[model samples]
Target: MDYMVIPDFVERKGSLYLRSDHMNYSRATLNSNWHQAREAEPKNYDINVFPKPPGRNLHTATYERIGHLKSKGLPNTTTKSALEQISLKPDFTERETRKSMVDVASFGHAIIDRELDAPSRGFGAVLPRHHPDYDKLHLETTHKADFTPPYPYDPAPERPPDFPDNSKAHRRYQSQFTDTADYRRSGRNTWQDESGVYGNTEDKRTVFPRTNPIPERLVQGLK
Candidate 1:
């Protein structure tokens, strides 16, 4: 499902409120896309809403506003109450808000600040639809999937070598880890030699290359 928004808010007089523009914009985009998708391909397009993991009833209010905008009916949106059963850590309200309402910009900015602002890589996992962890994993994946990032974002990378897949179950399990290695831990100051060479020390605990370093075999005409 594509085209989604997680609204921003400002706390005033003990009540949290989103900007008029924010609500209007979100409603417009959502409604337009909602109708377009239904007309274009009613069967395939499914609108999935993901509210900021709640503070007070702000999450509910945000979704309610969008829901009200639709003349037909509200499409598929993940409810805050349903999310309570699942663990979506990093309290959205506290972590996602800006200093002032004016500072709270576009939905794109909010998503980037939520995922990329941190020192370490954010939450991720690849799991099959049948697995117990699949729902949560899919939730995280879908949240990020809706956004058309300025930079390229690949969810499933190529399967790595040395993956034990001799057995059928092992091969099935291999699918769950296609993107596992992509989310590498940042190796800035953790493992540096006196010469300041990263991953050059004997500890070997932080020897992670930023990208796949394996050299491809020379072919007849390939560079």
Candidate 2:
């Protein structure tokens, strides 16, 4: 894995990153994404698969990790310990292993050499993002500001039709209060106003005063 990236590679594991907007690096979160292929992969080719195209080989460490996972729930396993053992002889490297597991998925799948996809949220994933019984802050809001109120209170642009991100945009949307002067003086010097996840911007950084749209009476009602 170490041989695939830039500068002081193996020694600098924490230095590399997959920027949120940067596709050059990948943030590999769990086994499902790349692990599916590595966990139950076929044999490594014995010959020189050389000058191989990108996404052409299985990453050794990833394969080893997933391989360990595949052995779960077997009969002889110990109840005392959950650790799965993998042999780490000093002699296993891409050069030493002699064969390489080829990545047929075009993502190369090399343990250390390529960027792998992180696990995606699955079928029941939406559950974590919302509360079934509790009304979402913005959805089901009958407050007048909750809708497209009026001037100086116009709605922010819809993120997009499907938006493709969290419904934060749709729900967080409320009638704007105050005038353009208030917006300007509110210190909205930067676009990066973070409520939670996305405030961390690598572009330019600054702050601004933010005003909530919900009328005080409505907020008390919801509470």
Candidate 3:
């Protein structure tokens, strides 16, 4: 059969990701999610038959490394050693090798691009100790291809939804706390209160003396 090889395109939705096949085979399998693909059998393809994508083709040095791995009894399985052998090669860039690993469900705990004196937690593939570039290797986190950056700084709004009920205790506290001589004095000279508890006039809300809702014990504590 004239086999087809799947391209390394990934799509992530929520915790699940659909990836291209990475079995080193020409039997193209697309949209294989990690959670489901790892349980299947490993594949073997003619190294020459598979079209070496622009950045993923193995050069002479990398092919030698793979040959070395084979000589050392490291089979073309999804084992940690096999993945590491691939990662330590010079043919594929770190990013390209990592994507390939993910396609084959071989993204162990993490990918070690640099020297690793000790094994790191949650990392499956590690840098080879005898590698010429071992000194320059370092640990790197493996994240989803479409990982999102964290949210920016955001302070809570002044007018919160804490006081919703209009109960006797609420009314009593509101009357005693709102619009008093001290409140008016604080409002007029808000600059004096550097803590910004009373807040500015822009939002027109007293952000000071934060509203702590403990309605269950409100009456008991007030008495």
**Predicted candidate 3 versus true structure: per-residue lDDT over 1-223, tens digit per residue:** 8879987455655523335545442334335554344333232432345565664445433232243355564445577667688666776555542335354456565574656665643355353344456588555556643464576567776766785432332222212234344454534443333333432332333333446677758768898
Q: Sort all candidates by lDDT, best to worst.
A: 3, 1, 2
Residue pairs in steric clash, candidate 2? 1-112, 55-107, 55-108, 56-108, 59-110, 59-111
Model 3, residue pairs in steric clash:
109-122, 109-123, 109-124, 110-123, 114-137, 114-138, 115-137, 197-208
Q: What is the lDDT of residue 149 in candidate 2?
A: 37
TM-score (all chains, Cα) for each model: 0.11, 0.11, 0.11
Q: Candidate 2 overall Cα lDDT vs. reference?
A: 0.42
Model 3 TM-score is: 0.11
After TM-score superposition, the amount by which residue 146's alpha carbon in candidate 1 deviates from its true location, in angstroms, is 4.2
Between candidates 1 and 3, name the one with more favorable lDDT.
Answer: 3
Best by lDDT: 3
Candidate 2's residue-wise lDDT over 98-194, tens digit each? 4445555744554653333532344544224434646746554466656753656655886767644433432433223423234443453734433
Model 1, span 109-170: residue lDDT tens: 55433443433422442322354554564445665778768887778877789754433322
lDDT of each: 0.42, 0.42, 0.46
List candidate 2 stretches off by more than 4 Å: 1-118, 123-147, 153-223
Output the worst ten-in-a-row residue range by lDDT, candidate 3.
Answer: 167-176
